[model samples]
Target: MTLSNTIRWLGMLAVIGGICRLLMTPLELMWGTDNTTALIIGGITGSVFIIIGTAGIYLFQAEKAGVLGFIGFLMTTLGNILVCTMVMIALFVNTALQDPQILEQDLPGPIVPIRIIMMITMNLGYILFGIATIRAKMLPRWGGALMILLVLMTFIPYTDYLFAVVWGLFYIVLGWAVWSRSKNSETKVSVTQ
Candidate 1:
């Protein structure tokens, strides 16, 4: 496949992932506990899609193989993988804990460590991915910059909702960029022909 096609695919994946995570926040907030099924599903889907997209960009050296893209891809890959791993661990923990009520508890014993691990890994992963977005032409550089901001925002205490909103905005920007770029390309090709 062409490099542009690959990038398009990757861009689509990011858009999808961003949207899913954005949507999940509300579900998580409403439930006030881990959405094990959603988390696992999103983790798997996001990882696969991102890998394909990142690989495409790397394989094609999209944009002269800028260090920014490479760094961004590295961060995104690591961060996304970490988040997925955390989700897997949470699933296992939830299953093994055998206490459905554990969800209701605020930071239960076994969950404390998991939560901490999740927080650290998750934030780091996002930071990296946000960086990757910055280096990509798939969307506006501002989207990536905003993603970086969102990543920073996550560090604030009791601001998960704020994080979610910022995160959603990032996706909205990315999605628009991807959609518009693809359309522009198609138009250019048709006109040339």
Candidate 2:
């Protein structure tokens, strides 16, 4: 597929991944929940999101996107990968297999630093990326602004599901924007021919 088509599909995948994250909140409440299943799903979705987010950053024409976009892409992609892997290990191996109570307790010393770093990178990176996207003017400004807002919402307590859904919506908008733009470009090309 062409680059535009690839970006469109990746954006769609990101939307789906965000939806999966929304589902995870409810699933976690189920009694005798299968952590393994959650981990597998989370890992897959997170991977998809990472790809789309990373690609989205670079897909913005480099000259216009600037240093902020590049930094955001690196941090966002790396943060997602690192956090997803750590979460899987924590939930599946550390808490599920070893001690269920571990989830209730504070993070262990080794895990604390990782969590801190992940939170900063993931949140800050997305915010920067959103700003960069808006600056680049390649996608809808509202979509990029919404991305920044959604990440900010994650910091609020008791709003996990709400933010996840909203985040998914933002991704859906982004995907639509990418897909429609590609389609429009193709139409223009065909018309010119």
Model 2, position 188: C-alpha lDDT score: 17
Per-residue lDDT over 153-188 for candidate 1, one digit per residue giving the tens place of the 0 to 100 score: 766788766665566566556655654576457311
Q: Tens digits of per-residue lDDT for model 2 on 1-193?
A: 7765666666566656666665554555553343555545644564557456456435633446678877877777777877676767666665546665575668767777787788888888888878887898877788779869878788678875566556556666665566566655631111121
Give the true-structure RMSD of model 1. Answer: 6.3
Best by the lDDT measure: 2
lDDT of 2 at 28: 59
Q: What stretches of model 1 exceed 4 Å from their correct place?
A: 41-44, 50-61, 99-138, 186-193
- Candidate 1 lDDT for residue 62: 37
Off by over 4 Å in 2: 26-39, 42-44, 60-63, 94-100, 186-193
Worst 10 residues of 2 by lDDT: 184-193
